[model samples]
Target: MRPKIYLYGDSITEESFGDGGWGASLSHHFSRTVDVVLRGYSGYNTRWALKVAERIFPPVESGGVPPLAVTVFFGANDACLPDRYSAFQNVPLHEYKQNLHSIISFFKKRWPEIVILLITPPPIDEDARLRHPYIENPSGLPERTNEAAGAYAQACISVAKECGCPVVDLWIKMQECPDWKQAYLSDGLHLTQAGNRIVFEEVVKKLKEQGISVENLPVDLPLIANIDPQDPLKAFQDY
Candidate 1:
């Protein structure tokens, strides 16, 4: 059976299978070698994800192939300002950190050999958020801010180090580009194709560091190139 790679997070992850999305890129990158499973919930926070973690990834004893790796990508919603329209999604920073610790612990308990890759929330563009408000904002303020997202990103990285897991510090990586607000983010929060590409590259690079590269993983079945046209059934005989 092909080893699986799980993507667990909120809206960013929910949209990760869309055209030019990072998740789709990973699927293509590891084609036939692994299954990239997504467990994403739009508009969810760590608190909510923690609540549903077991449901999404039940104990391996429950009868499913355990994943080789899991990417935890969340925090955008959790950084929303308490006074904003999206305040309902906001989780206090300390609690957010705790939730991440718990989430990682849950996965470790369920799959002791699992490789966890933590992804920090990408930086936001307040100007773009104002232009693309989720609702008409009478206050004319963006529900989220780059500073808040940075804080969350830091918290995420801290958690990864504490838990001894690999991490993709996306917020810092994206900002390394001079025009990241326009090049990487679509609506200040969601990612553009360029942004997705950055994520794809970073994820592949990080996974490679953990010795989970495509070159290291075996293809699930015989290569079609090796099949004889006259005896195609030979491939299936052993399959």
Candidate 2:
């Protein structure tokens, strides 16, 4: 069976398979070698992720194969202001860190050999949030702030270090651009096509570091190059 890579997170991850999305890019890059599974939950925070962890990531059977790798990307919603309309998604800083640790532990316990990667939340753009607010912006203010998001991003990094897992510091990386607010982020919170590319590149780099790259993995079946023009049927016979 082809090995699998799981993308587990919130809306950012949930929309990662759309046009010009990072997940789609990964799928294309690793085509014929591995299966990239999408298990993102829209509007979910770390707190909610913990609640639904078991249901989404069930244990592997005694003899079943576990996923080759998993990416945990959350914290955008968790950084929402406690007093804002999106307060329902706000998880305190301390709890947010603990929740991330727990999530990693859950995956490690189930798949001892799995390569877990943590992705920090992208930076926020308050002006964009005001320009394109959610349908129910009761407070008429940005529910999230870049500063708050940065704090959560730091927490995510700390958790990754504590658990000895690789991490994608998206928050800091995205801000390296001068116009990140408009170029990288679609809304104040979500990612744009350019932003998705950044994610795809970073993820590929991290996976490669852990020895899970396309070049390292075997293709599922015989390559076309191996088939002879006069005896193409011979190639699949032995497969």
Candidate 3:
């Protein structure tokens, strides 16, 4: 069976298979080599994800092949400012940190061989948020802010360090770009094509750093040109 890579998180991840999305890019890049599984639940926080993680990703010890890699991307919803947004979705900073640590620890203890990557929440664009029809506030403010998201991102970074896991620091990296508000994020909270590209490239870079070579991955099947028309079975058997 082909190796699997799981992308687990919230809305950003749920839409990651859409046009110009990072998940789609990864799928294309790893074609015939690995299965990129999307385990995204839109609008979910770490608290919600932790409750369902076991059901979604069974312990590797239970059987079958464990995923080659798994990315834990949360914090976006958890970073929601309680005073502005629904309290149901808001997770305290301390709890957010704890949840991330628990999630990473669970995976590490369950699947020691699997590579884990923790992704920091990307920065939010207040201007874009205010312009969004559904996100308009009476005070002309956004429910989330870059500053708030940055705090969660730092928490994620801290968790990564504590767990000895690699991380994709999206919050910091996105801001480094020129006019990142327009260039990276589409709706202040979500990623655009360029943003997805950045994510895909970063993921590839991380995998390389972990000694996982995409170029060296074996294709799912033998090349058609290598098949013998007169002896199809021979080619199949050889492969």
TM-score against native, each model: 0.95, 0.97, 0.92
lDDT per residue (tens digit) for residues 1-239 in model 2: 88889999999999999999999999999999989999999999999999999999887777777899999999999999999888899999999999999999999898899999999999999988988877667567898999999999999999999999999999999999998988999988899999999999999999999999999999888888887999889888865
Residue range with the least summed lDDT across 10 consecutive positions in model 2 = 131-140
Separate clash counts for every candidate: 0, 0, 0
- Model 1 CA RMSD to the hidden true structure, in angstroms: 1.5
Per residue, candidate 1 scores C-alpha lDDT tens digits across 1-239 of: 78899999998998999999999999999998999998889999999999999888866655667889999998999999888989999999999999999999999998899999999999999999999998898888899999999999999999999999999999999999999999999999999999999999999999999999989999888889988899998888975
Among these predictions, the greatest TM-score belongs to 2
Question: What is the lDDT for 125 in model 3?
Answer: 91
Supply the TM-score for candidate 3.
0.92
Q: How many residue pairs in model 2 have overlapping backbones?
A: 0
The RMSD (Cα, Å) of candidate 3 is: 2.0
For 216-237, candidate 3 gives per-residue lDDT tens digits of 7787887678778888788677
Report the Cα lDDT for residue 199, model 2: 99
Of the candidates numbered 1 and 3, which has the greater TM-score value? 1
